[model samples]
Structures are given as C-alpha cells and as structure tokens.
Target: MKASTISLIIHGVDVDVVYKKVKYLRIGVYPPLGQVRVSAPTRFGHEQVRLAVIERLPWILRQREHFQTVERQSRREMVSGESHVVFGAAHRLQVIEQPGRERVEADADHLLLFVQAGSTPEHRLALLERWLREQLRQAVIALIAVWEQRLQVTVPQWTIRQMKTRWGSCNPQTRRISFNSELARKPPHCLEYIVVHEMAHYFHDGHGDGFTGFMDSHLPDWRSQRRELNKR
Candidate 1:
C-alpha cells in the first residue's frame, strides 16, 4: 500500500489530506494551532476527502475554539490580578514589594511573587520564568523516573525548554527527551501525558500502530489528555 500527501483548504482552514492504503477514513485536528489532517484510502479521490472534512466542519470548529479560548490567553503583564496557570488550576497573581529574596509562592488561589521595590516588569518576568522552569524541570524529572522503570529504558538525559511547535520530543539514539517549558502552565495530567508519550518513543520512534498500541496499553485515557493538553 503506497502513501502520498497533499494540501487543500476547507472553510478557510488549511488541511493536509493523506492518501494511504487503508480501509477507512480518519481525521485529526492537531495543535499549536488547529491543523486539520485526514487519512483516507488510496481509492478515495480529493473530492471524497473534501466532503469528509465538510461533514466534520462543526467538530473541527469546536476544536479550534478550545485552542483559542483556553490555550491562547492574552499576553501576561506579570502584575497583580493577572491570571496565571499552575498545575492546570487558574490562580491570580499578587506581587508583593519587599527587599528580600525574589521568590514565588502559591496557595490554592494565588501565585504570590515577592520582589524588591521598584523592580521593572522585565525583572519580574525573569523571576517568574526562572521559577516556572524550575517547576517544570522537577515535574519532568519525577515523571521520567517513573516511566523509565515502567518502560525498562534508561534515558541518558532530559531537559525542559521553550518549544514553539511541540509538547515534547525524543531522540531515541541518544536516549534523551526534551519537554516544553509551557507544560508548567498546563494541567498535571497533560504534563504526565507528554512525559509518557516521549518515553514511549524509547520503544517506538514514530506515531504508528506500534506506538499507538503502546500508549493505549499504558495510558488508556491518553487521547483525552492529549486533547486537553492541546487546548491549553
């Protein structure tokens, strides 16, 4: 069964339609932005694919709405009353001006930032970024340890960094995984999903049947979590 791919536009959304040697049609909406992709039998023509997308247009719009309403929040000013997310919970930020160590503390409803008086917004942002990075790193490390034992694979290294397009990535040859720093702002389960997804790559490099099967066996609700993560 040979495979080929092409692109088309439906209702103003760019779509990637893949012709594969398969039995049924499958469609998916992916993130950072909602990218619509369809997989159809090689026998299906472009018109068939376009009609399928048209049938799912409502669902596609809903998925895009989730990304816009949840994941694409307004720019942060890092000031009091600003909304911040931690562990999937929304918290209001409270900046406390004090001549002490710059740090962050969080309770159920507030992310308190203690900074010196007259600190610039840039300085405040830097402090928050460092704290978020540390938080993400700790979460990634703990998850890696757990998955490594379960998957029976030794990860040589892993790091948390800003990624514009991916939630996480793996280099199986190097046994290293890199997580997006933004995971700190998403729900805990989302972070866990990315960790396990990357670790699964240790056994399966691509998102083919083998990898999908492995994920289903390990995390039954992975698809749900993945949708939520992309919405963040």
Candidate 2:
C-alpha cells in the first residue's frame, strides 16, 4: 500500500510523517539539510507521531546538528585558502585573478581558480559549478556505457542538478535519470554506484528484496559506498 504523509512542525524543526503498515515508529534525519521523517504505524494518529518525535528529540537534535556542520562545510566563501572538496579530497582554494575567461583548475591538493581580476563570489561559484558539471557528466557517460549494457537497459536521457535531499532519482517509464551535482564532490566509485543504482530502478521500483538482490549481485560493496557517500 502507498504510505500517506503528513507534515508537522515540532520544536521548530520540520517533520514528515509517513504512515505505514508497520508495528513500530521509525525516525530518520536526512541530509543536504537536516530533514526529519518519521514512519509510524497506520493505526497511530498524528498525536502519537508527535509524541514519538518528542521522545526522541535529543537524538534528532544531535543528528540535525551534524548535518548543519556538513552544510557549513559545503557552503564555501569562494576565496583563497578556503577548503573545498573535489573528488572526495579536501583541496585548498586559490583564487588567481588574471585577464582571461574565468576557469577552474585543480591539482592534487589545490583548486586554482583563475578569475577576471574582480570576479565576485557568485561568478567564481558559477565557474566552479560549470566545471564540476562537466566533470560529473563525463564520468556519468562512461559509467552509463558500462552499466546500461550490464543492466540491459537504455537511459534515454539523464541530467545533473543541485538536489537538496536526494543523491539521485529516476523515472523508469521515461528511462531517464537525474543525479545530484554534489556527486562531483564525492569519490568516483560513489558516482558509479549511483548510476548503477538508478539504472537498476528500470527493473525494480523500490528498495525491496528485488532491488536489494540486484544491487548485491552487481555491486557487493554498495552498502559501504553508500555510507561513504552519505558521510559529510
């Protein structure tokens, strides 16, 4: 059955309540920003769900604090000496103001941003994001080639966007997929795992046994990669 959802504000935090046919209530804090979600048995009312969230309030607050720390890390100032992530490694940013078109370049431990002398932070960010998108695109294309054949599915189209709460999503009917641009900041393996994961959705709709089996058969270490990718 499809779960019914209700939205609530508890102690200044937004909570999404999903009523499911389960015996117990489950709570989770998700990322990009701290989003609290609760899975409650269908028999429970909204009051019961609220109480459940209050009972676990401390733990939820801690989890939200962790996500805030991660958010601050991702929100950069676009200046020299600022720490930035590229391909899962921390790279210090160096803004080199010059006379040409703005471009982003990086070595093993540093990101060299060449701007037009007086570029604003927004302009620098735009340049960096443009570069990151191309990086993610090339990686996705190569991975899709291998995965489409292995999974026996064709991805008619795919896109990269700034998703606040999801690493990736897919439309099985359209045979199209979308990946989070944030994946560019993660390891290559993480991106590969997401590609295979979304592609597998063409066969299975949810994370049920069918999807689990598919992932297990194809990528045995997917759980580890998931943990790494979810880590801030």
Candidate 3:
C-alpha cells in the first residue's frame, strides 16, 4: 500500500483511508500508547478515517484517562494561605491589606498579596493572579530567547497562559508557540523543557521518532525534566 493509504479495523470491519498529500503513514500499538503521528499533510478522509482510527481505540481511551488525570492535577485555586509552586519551589500566599499598595509581590519565600485597605478579597485575588501571569510571561519570554539560541531555532510568536491540560503546543505553520503560564510556578528546568520541546517542533512538526531523537540529541535530561514537571 502507498504511504498515504491508512488501513485499520473498526467495528469488526477493515477500512482504508487515503490522504492526498501524505507521503507516509505508520501505526503502532504499545503500552500506555495511542496514535503518534507525523503527517506531512493536513487533509485526510473523514468517514473512512473513523474506521481507520478505531484500531487504536484502546490507546485512545487510555490517553483520555491520562488527560483527565493531568487536568485534575493542574487545578489550583488562587487563595490566601494556599501553597503554590514558584520556580519549582513551594511558597504560601500571605494576604496583607496595606494602606496604599495595590500590587502583589513575591519575596524569597512567600507571595505577599497586598491590596488597598478597603479592597475586597476577590479584587485582591484578581490582582495577585494578574501579577503572577505577568511574571510568568516575562520568564517564558526570557527562557524562549535563551533556548532559541541554544537550539538554533527561531519562533516568530508565542503566548503564555494557563492551560487546562497541555504544558505547551506549537503551530508549525505559523511558527508560533503557546505555553501554559502555570509553568512559571514550576521549576526552571520544567520551563526549559517546554521551550525546547516546542522548538523541536519547528523542525519536526509532530511527536514521532524524529521528534524524540531530536530531543534526546539536544537535551539528554529532557525526560527527567518532563517527569518532574508532570509531578507538579
């Protein structure tokens, strides 16, 4: 079969799907695994595709479960006295109402949540969250610059925001990357891992063998950093 032709069994029936531009198609089944693709084309058959994708239905189900686990793990309500990660270190938020200051500050060990004396708790929380996001954005930009030099890749644009399940995603076509701003709270290495991971996508658009090889060749400790990041 041509590389563009994809075949699989679904609902006790075998189906073949083809892509007009795809030059290769490969599938595999492994533990804790699902569909890991490296497609050169963006278009594919829809109806027959359903049947083709069903061969990995078990893996897809496992991936969904893992996604849910990560989603639950990433939830953190910004609250006073709650412990939060900062640069991979744990710190407690200390709410303080001052006479004049309306900004939040992070000291060596604690996040000093300051607000106007008459400000409501909700307002204080909002201010703190916004401040944290700004801090994360700055850190992400700095990190991206450092990695762009280290990896010899250029990213045209990127954004930092709180993501529900993914640490980051890369749009090869646009040469843009989006990272979970929550990473600012994680360890510095975690941030580096994400930046490098996205940079790799610039060369290999998908998470395939080539992607893994690139990561291994560039950062041998990537797996460790990834594991640590997930733990947080």
> Per-model C-alpha lDDT, please?
0.84, 0.86, 0.68
TM-score quality measure for candidate 1: 0.75
Task: Give the per-residue lDDT digits (tens) of candidate 1, residues 46-101.
Answer: 99889999999999989867665655565577789988888789989999999868
Between prediction 1 and prediction 3, the one with superior TM-score is 1
Note each model's CA RMSD in angstroms.
5.0, 4.0, 7.3
Predicted structure 1: lDDT: 0.84
- Candidate with top lDDT is 2
Distance (Å) between predicted and true CA of 134, model 2?
A: 1.2
Give the winner by lDDT: 1 or 3: 1
Q: Is candidate 1 or candidate 2 better by TM-score?
A: 2
What candidate 2 gets wrong by more than 4 Å, as runs, is: 1-23, 35-73
User: For candidate 3, what is the lDDT?
Assistant: 0.68
- Across 1-232, the per-residue lDDT of candidate 3 in tens digits comes to 2224344556643333434455444333211112233232335555535644565667655664675665566555555678866787778888776677577778777988767666675676578668878888888888888888887777889988666546788887998899886676778888889889988989885565677789999989999987787662
What lDDT tens digits, residue by residue, belong to model 2 across residues 52-74?
Answer: 89999999999888887877766
**Ten consecutive residues with minimal summed lDDT in candidate 3?**
29-38
Off by over 4 Å in 1: 1-29, 33-73
| Best candidate (score: TM-score) | 2
lDDT of 2 at 186: 95
